[model samples]
Target: MKVIMYHYVRRYNPSLPHFRFLDVENFKKQLDYFAENFGFVSQSEWATWVTTGQMPHQPDKIILTFDDAMSCHYDYVYPELLKRNLWGIFYACSQPYLTGKMLDVHRTHVLCGAFEGRTLVAASEEVVSPDMIPNREREEFTSQTYRNQENYSGVSRFKRMLNYFVDPALKTHILDKIFEHLDYQVDSKGFYVSQENLIEMNNNGMIIGSHSVTHTLLSTLSLDQQRYELEESFRFIESITAQRDRTYCHPYGGTRSYNKDTLSILEQLNTDYAFSVNYRDIDDTDFVSSRQTLPRYDCNLFPHGLAS
Candidate 1:
């Protein structure tokens, strides 16, 4: 069995090309491939089969998962999954959904949509065509811009204050505008799946899983803090799902983000399982492969377009 994770999926609409997510067509092709190629199983079934040796007589099974609860999932992925009668899990970070805070980042994301490919410094350059320059050159330009400024002594003194009240990169075409929007949203808003959204997602067979309340890296925090994060996430997710099942996925499950101590804490919490972003190695014995450290392949990484 293999588990696959996916993030953004939507049409690459140019107007909001920042929101130009994975085109809906490519997303559909992946789904079709999943349906035709292997048995799609829920996380629960996969867990059970791993431990109890019970499966529905299939040669292979794959589990699908999505992270971040991006609005794009609601607009694009959900309908497609429903149309095909597929089930999956959605690991949501609770903060953005509760407040329109996503608008904070998203708005910045939009304003600077054109700067997506450029570095933070290049995006700050005054030139109209910043993207034409390479990242290293852009860094040098921005460094020079900062170096040439005279009133920046006071600016540096109150840097945090300025970051909070105003976006410094507000003049770089689309980039600055995007940051402005995000700043406005984060300071004054919140976005969460409405109660209705949660109920509907569950009813449609999507299991709700925790991605932490604040999305902090668990391994980086103190032991107590890590435990608190794990427990709080478990309770909040269980409340949202109205299920006794407790499962969690580490944020940035890549090499540096999750480590042995983090796994130890999760084991103590007795979480059913936790997923990591690490990929491509699976063996039958891998079933017992540390409940707190399961490897998952991202759909975006593979050629067959299957997520796991």
Candidate 2:
């Protein structure tokens, strides 16, 4: 079976033209495309596969998963899925809702969207300390970090500096400084689906899963920190959504995004499975062995997934 991953799904943001996201019109078209060509596995079938070791019979079936639980999912995707009687897995970060603050990772996205790369590069240099900027070449960094799309030439170094090299506290500080300098205000609370929306979706057969507390790289944190980020986020989601299934998707999914400590924590907590950004089709072999790090194809790779 194939699994498809989605992040932002909304109409064109005229104000933020550079911002990259799946267009809602295209998303509807993609659903139509899938309905005509492929079978969709329901949430119950997915749970059965996890627990009863039964594979979905449809040869060309697909499981839909939405990450970040973006407001667009509630606004556009959820109602459309409900109309078709389809279910999906939505992974949400608890900190954004609990603290009512923008995540640093998303701040990078906003920075990239609101301003041009050259402008952002200048602002990043002015806001952050000299030592914070890495000595790495832009091409080398962007080649690895953003292989799927056009290399963000000017912004790549800026992204690398904030995302990887800087300390988390300092990263947040730098992002705040830049935002202040640019006079850009991100609507943190309105950015994601609310607890009520999650509960409604769950009640209607959608699966609500944990996407960690702070949405930081799990591999960068200590073992105890990783455990707290995973388990605490899981508990928080369960309390609010009454989610019976225990599943997680890595904050920034990649091989390096999670470690042995993460897997160990999930095992101890009796998690059913986790999602990874490995980019491949899942088969019966993966069901038997690689439940924790199952791969998913990016929505951008499919027809009608990207804006023309």
Query: In terms of lDDT, which candidate is strongest?
Result: 2
**Which candidate has the top score in TM-score?**
2
RMSD of each: 9.9, 2.2
In the range 80-148, model 2's lDDT, one tens digit per residue, is: 999998989999998887888877888788778778888888888788886665434534444556456
Going through the candidates in order, what is the number of backbone clashes in each?
19, 0
- How would you encode candidate 1's per-residue C-alpha lDDT over 281-305 as one tens digit per residue? 3445554765666778777654444
Off by over 4 Å in 2: 133-142
Cα deviation at 288, candidate 1, in Å, is: 1.8
Query: C-alpha displacement of 13 in model 2, angstroms?
Result: 2.3
- TM-scores, in order shown? 0.69, 0.93
Clashing pairs in 2: none
